[model samples]
Target: MKKNILLIGGSYGIGLELVKQLSEDYSVYVASRTSEGLEGTSATHITFDANTDSLDITALPNEIHGFAYCPGSINLKPFKMMSLDTFESDMQLNFFNMVKIVKDTLPLMTAGGAIVLFSTVAVGSGMPYHTSVAAAKGAVEGFAKALAAEYAPNIRVNVIAPSLVNTPLAKRLLSNDKKIEMMSQRHPLKRIGEVEDIANTAAFLLCEKSSWITGQVIGVDGGMSTLNLS
Candidate 1:
């Protein structure tokens, strides 16, 4: 039987890639705020808005094999200039919204089902102008671990913390050649990340091959998180 997997916020970027790749082998259900005319013939698109306080969980399947929360924010600004509303908004989108979705979908997840969430390398290692996003993603890391521990032997939870991926979300950071070169040089790999780099990891985690992994924060940042080629 094809594994039933639901990808939230999968209209574009890594989420879109996952839907495309996974649809080849698994049944994929995509949910996002706005409808996306995705080209995957095998995937199903569902109307979902994470910002809404009231959501109908019954709209989803009764048994889900995997779930990926792909919603995120790239708000990078100085701490002094950032307002509380900005911080709260980021947290709501990246952390709290994910929490609500997982809670509502818990009953639908089969035994051994997994959950994957996106974070940023800034959450672990400090970065300038990343206070709001870092704080929000930091909460996701915490949530993943706690849920992983609590649901051990039944469900798996993991996070992918990436740096400078070339997605629409990061386009502003790499719009100009100078900006692109600056970001590329910051990492030991000498280039920003690609969506495939992260999407592949998501597919692995959702599949049975990574059944043993849980509560882990895997960094797909091209050696930026751990390596220093000085």
Candidate 2:
């Protein structure tokens, strides 16, 4: 039997791309509210909503080799216009729920298992209209590092902090050619991140190739975090 990998959200975007890449080599299990875009993958789909429902652990394999949480939000609003509740909501979706899932399912992982989480480039680089999400994702980055230290040599934990990508989650930002061009120019790469860019790195982290890596936040940004070419 192949190794099992559980993903919290794999219906679309980077998660779906990772599912497509990993299912070929591992037994992929995806837990999401809808099986939309997963119609033909070899993955086992479980209906789950992180906002309200716990993972249907009964549907998972006895042992899980990897896990990734892919659900995220891109709330770009002025700080003052946004209330405290806005920040809390981002925390609930991005940090608290992930913590609950990992804690609940970690028992299924023994040694050499990898856990992947998502953050944002804004977490490290201060961007206007990103205060709420940046705070939330900052918590995620901090949590991943601590978790990795605690579980070192047993389970590997890492984070992927990405810049804007051309995913459904960012459709509004890159809706048109002019907007796409503007966003692209902000990065040294001069192009927005593709789902594959993030997913490929994610797949590597989950596999034995990255066996020695953990307790780190890998930037998958398009050189936006560290680049100054004027």
lDDT for each candidate structure = 0.89, 0.94
The estimated TM-scores of all candidates read 0.96, 0.99
Q: In candidate 1, which residue pairs get closer than 3 Å at backbone N, Cα or C atoms, i.e. clash?
A: none
* Residues 8-105 of candidate 2: C-alpha lDDT, one tens digit per residue: 99999999999999998999999998897998899999999999998877788899999999999998899889889889999999999999999989
Best by lDDT: 2
Tens digits of per-residue lDDT for model 1, 94-129: 989989989888889999899999999998899999
- Clashing pairs in model 2, backbone N/Cα/C closer than 3 A: none
lDDT of 2: 0.94
RMSD of 2: 0.7
For candidate 2, give the lDDT of residue 58: 79
